[model samples]
Target chain A: MALCQTSVLKVYHAVIEDVITNVRDAFLDEGVDEQVLQEMKQIWRNKLLASKAVELSPDSSDGSHPPPIVANNPKSNKAANAKAKKAAAATAVTSQPQIGGSSSASSLVALKSSAGMAAGSGMKNGLVPIKQEVNSQNPPPLHPTSGAALLQKQQQAASSGQGSIPIVATLDPNRIMPVNITLPSPAGSASSESRVLTIQVPASALQENQLTQILTAHLISSIMSLPTTLASSVLQQHVNAALSSANHQKNLAASKQLDGALDSSDEDESEESDDNIDNDDDDDLDKDDDEDVEHEDAAEEEPLNSEDDVTDEDSAEMFDTDNVIVCQYDKITRSRNKWKFYLKDGIMNMRGKDYVFQKSNGDAEW
Target chain B: MSYQLYRNTTLGNTLQESLDELIQYGQITPGLAFKVLLQFDKSINNALNQRVKARVTFKAGKLNTYRFCDNVWTLMLNDVEFREVHEFVKVDKVKIVACDGKSGEF
Candidate 1:
């Protein structure tokens, strides 16, 4: 009796497995939407759980519990054979309609026989007593539009083959239709696992290029808005240092040139003064012609003074030109007034040029 | 990232790299000191307006000093000796003065 009960449990379990497998495959093949498939799977899972509870019940008196077998060894050949026979019968019933051309009458006979055997066994143990009651109380709802009507429609369309079904026209323009998306799954799992991704269809559903452009423009503007005072300050310092050094070098060069010119002029003046002393000594030697000597001495002295005046004028001109050049360069390079004040206050004016500074009273004093 | 506005190819090294490279490394010598001057000289005659003059003063030696102007820029070395200006070159240390009439300096 125990062997029989175990065999019956095994057979029921196998039937449940077959149903679950079929439902899963149908869901995949039909491209069933996830929400609908999830609801169907939930119902099937509840049914499976309930059936398992019934099979595993310990009380023999419970109407849902199968009969307890009295066999000493439940795994005997007889028990195995009975279980195998039940499985074969179940497979035959399922395969017949799927393979096609099994007459409706034969299919009905097989279904009735299985149903009768299950009912009879269930009644012996008082299991599933409410199943028949429920079936009688409420019949399965009929399709609003019958399957036969749908079949007729399909046939008519096939015969005509001129117009396509108008279902495509019902799609909303704004709706984001599902498209296949492949994304990498978490590591260490099987490589076959794919993440759920909902890709919008029709391409125009997303203005990807425009969105990217707007984002890029905003990023650039934000970055540009940041204050770069530190960097600017460092750059300005370096620039100012460079300019100051250049100005210094320039001043040194101008000073050296001026010194060379001044030294040459000094040497010329000393030579002229020495020549005058020699002419005086010659006049002393020829004292008898006094008027002639005095006339020649006056002539020589006038030319010497005139040459000194010309040299002074030349020196003044050189100073003026140098001043103009240096001032212009300083104004152009250090226009910020930060460095301008520094240059104006520094030793720049003393090289070869005359200093020019406006007094506090706004007087043009140089 | 730091940003800078560049004109007439005078942007130096250390400038942020970007599409601005076209305006920076395109013709500008990197690390050279340059003063920004506002001038409208894009025409052919303006093109021949002569190479922009840059006067630089540097310490030649302890007692020897030098002042020179050149169109080309050279890193560390004398501009007169460099002969050619690289797209990215360094200026050792020198002052930059804008010769144009616009008063505001860089």
Candidate 2:
């Protein structure tokens, strides 16, 4: 075909396939299991279609711009040949890390103080978007109304056969993750195996949602590989740790907000005294007093979830409600079934069995 | 499992030191130590905001020490390095200090 004439209709299937392959390899390298890998692939395919839908202007983005030829469907082309010479011309770009880290400790502190203020003052306006603007490099120039509409569209799409929203996390292998997470044993195993996995803790630059996916993927890989008895406990502990961290952040945020409100009021008071002729001081004072009371109440209030039911669902009928899947391994009979495990005080327990951490021996006894 | 317990103990000790330092420094009240410990991980997250280096150490007595260090903060257990230990120094309250890791008056 190339010898006959220069052709544009011929699709370079290899280029697109290479991109998909890269995605697959990255997820697999990150320890995603087969089922989850399939799920992620589906998400990526949908995303490719979505990206192809919106043709970005050259001015809009730099390296992440897709090829000029936008396919109505991402999977439409099935080209057999993509010459190595042409590959560079249509080289697929690796997307940058979507989530940006807080620049420094000082800025983070400022964010916390502001988060505190927002939570305390009950100021519903601009809190979320502002945070997003700060965190995202290409924070879709969204006005509040447009952002809301976009969110609504996403929710509707999610409701209609779409899977969980995709979470992307970048791991810095150079920096080990601080926590040590244990892995689950293999499915339908006869003997118990002890394989301790100390996951390199992902850095703070990675957000909670991304970290959750990374952890889940690793958990799946571990569970698939080993003959572990403490699969449920491991999941429970890790999830709870993240959950606990979130709750603590909320509490701290609330307290900081109250303090911020009080400080602002004090500053306002000092300013009002400096300008004694300002007649609106009385009205402002009354408003400040009300806000102060509310702030105080907010500061003292506990987090919304007192109970540690990770999913916080109140049903007992389904195994999937908790989003936790536990496989049982019977050593004697060599049988496996869905094992029932529950978390108490953030400790995972096998049903009808007490789990004890032997401090001296450093092994778990059930 | 023993590592978790050991980590917990070391964490507890670090937290105690942090709380005591804060209370002695009049940054936070003494009774709030329990509250602080419950939410110790937050401090860890905040401390991780800075550049840090961590190292793990082992001794003959089944002793494992984790150490963490940053430009402004250094946390250690059993003289080992805690690249992300999130512990108090002999006196600094970077990990234990509530709300921005700078003040206890709140």
Candidate 3:
């Protein structure tokens, strides 16, 4: 049996429903609204659907029929961001007149209408409509960037945890200025401090939940304030760790070239020498040969050190790519250092989609 | 002791991202986000256990690295081939992180 995109979507839907159902009371206990939990689920599902990487058609077991047209325009995106901020801001400014009649019907519906209005006003304001034709029926889609920024800001506030009055002010203006006014200064110093704290703190410093909460808050704030590429930089750091080994090899070859008494070096000969120094000693009669031989022995061990560090960092690298498996090992048997793994309850992310598996057997050697 | 490793998956990342949006807007707290993730752990584990009946088998051309730490097995495989009933998917490299399924209070 194999899981398809639809099945994966179904599993995701089930998981969201299950989580909301279970965590609702806990959140309520913490003075959080049940509606907020539902909204979180909606936002989570919408963002996943927007990825358009997985198909959640109407006929699928996943019953929430996502909006047909994902409008992917600046207008809709702005509207979505504004609506989110307004929703966040609504709690703070209880006096402001709700955009729509009822608070429940207001957010999404108001976003659709307001998105059209914003789009309409933009066109009237000499904003040239390039390829996008303003259609009322097709409201602006929830673009992921605005959604990410929105989340970034939200997490930044949430990290502050309590009495974060400044966040409301930041959102009220609906301009980039507020972020600069509120975040950059404190976030710069705090981010470095928290990062050091996270590094210094042991796994058992606080309760798991509290630790996760603190780390997540720090991570979100730092990520939000990062001026460079956002998520890509985080991922690049991980990839670079693995890449360092390759780079070390390249550097090793370069050093070998210089050590060869400035002779015009052949790449193949250098590679062969690195692999087998004894063979290289017989093959190449070069000056400074003793120095090169001694350097090769030391250089050979550098890659192993690189490999060790890479493996240590492996635990932190996210397995969110298309070709990874997040699962549970029922039992792992090792005979003569060869291992056989029995895995279960697996979510295999492959081929740019997701799959669920009940049982899997993997064969590998130590 | 619900498995939190799945939180690194795409679904988990999206939820965290969404929760971030809510938190940044002051709609929810970081604590609430953590609660959501805990629930997510339980929910996803249960969903995968009860809903998915599919079985898969795979062989690795070479197991690059393997580590067993904290009752979790992390295996990095190169040149792997996965076979399902109907199709097969081959990947250059794949990482498998499996936690103790039956060890926790599910």
Candidate 4:
């Protein structure tokens, strides 16, 4: 029975070893890129160095063992790591010259010596550089770049019957390089070029229901600030607006004159009807014939008299101008219902001075 | 350097001729900058606005003339000058054409 038990134990031990070897081979087959693998090795080395430094320090007393002086304390670990990273980056920048010289050779020699000490210390002194080498050489194929290998190694170390020796590993560090670029220049010489000004107006500047007023104010301010030569073109646009208004007024005046002439002609027709009634009693027998003759005469005279009347009415309308004028003066300038005024040569040339309104009202009413 | 421009026909040629004349008169050149003004009578404005999209084209010789806004008119070769003229004229009605020598037509 004793012999059988011994054989069973041996078989169990052999099986476990095979399992471990398979896991290691699987990691190795995964074939992580050499750069990443090298970086991982460097990180592991740093972690080992840090833990060793912490163990040499006297302040810590966790009862397991004296922690390394280089091991960052839990309380200040994040800040220390950041500072270390910055220091490492600066050193890397400075070490670029050393990369091609004897200094690199000396550093490599130092690294080898330190790696040897870490390996010799074993798990009792909490040094496990050999374990890092073993994992690096035989990383699992399924998870070559995964953190799982590191975790599994930690577990194995813990279960290896090595008492209370703390295991440490490092994290991957981020690196960035600087770059330079240039932009092409725009056409035209600097002296002759016009600069584009973009101004952002906040929504609050436009208050509720006052968008037009605020916009006009902003536009006027910008225009007024411009050089006179540039502002003249903008000012010319105002003249065009005035001309359009004058044209509208002229059309309205012509229509009003036509309406007046039609009313006068209707009055003349009513008078003729009364005159025919007076003549009808005097000659009742010939009244129908005379009425026909009179109607023909009236038709013949109507067009000629209407044309004359239109001319007269137009002349009278031009002279008898009782009209109101509204002119805006501030941010926006506007002239409303000024029929007696005409736009000529970029100016509002008033035909009848008496038609001008002395008082002005705000455009908000319109 | 001055170069003569030749054309086979004159149909729709009034604006092109005017631009060519302006260039010949040394009023504009390939490197010289100048502004152009175009006026469209109400009928023309209505007809073109309803049917055409504005574009500018350049013809180069000893002098370069730029045609703009439905190719109805031509101007000198400054882009900034063209933009200035465009701003002055009512784009929906009249097309203004101008140019500076540096950047051709836009």
TM-score versus the correct structure, for each prediction: 0.12, 0.15, 0.47, 0.12
Residue A139, model 4: lDDT of 34
* lDDT of all predictions: 0.26, 0.28, 0.56, 0.27
Best by TM-score: 3
Model 3 misplacement above 4 A: A27-35, A57-64, A68-322
The interface RMSD for candidate 4 is: 38.8
Output the worst ten-in-a-row residue range by lDDT, candidate 3 chain A. A204-213
C-alpha lDDT of candidate 3 relative to the true structure: 0.56
Better candidate by lDDT, 3 or 4 = 3
DockQ scores of the candidates: 0.01, 0.01, 0.37, 0.01
Ranking, DockQ, top scorer first: 3, 1, 2, 4
lDDT of 3 by residue, A36-100 (tens): 87777777777676666466655652445445245223323754787788788887676454433
- Point to the candidate with the largest lDDT: 3
| lDDT (10s digit) by residue, model 3, range B54-79 | 78888888777787898888788878
Worst lDDT 10-window in candidate 1 chain A: A357-366
- By TM-score rank, best first, the candidates go 3, 2, 1, 4
Can you tell me which runs of candidate 2 are displaced by over 4 Å? A1-13, A23-25, A47-269, A273-366, B1-106
Candidate 1 shows a clash count of 5
Pairs of residues clashing in candidate 1: A1-A69, A1-A70, A2-A69, A63-A126, B12-B31
Error of 2 at B37 (Å): 38
Q: Chain B TM-score in candidate 3, rounded to 2 decimals?
A: 0.93
lDDT, candidate 2, A91-163, per-residue tens: 5322211122222334433343233333222212211111111112223223322222223222222233123
Q: Please give the distance, in angstroms, between residue A83's alpha carbon in candidate 2 and its true position after superposition.
A: 41
Indicate the TM-score of model 4: 0.12
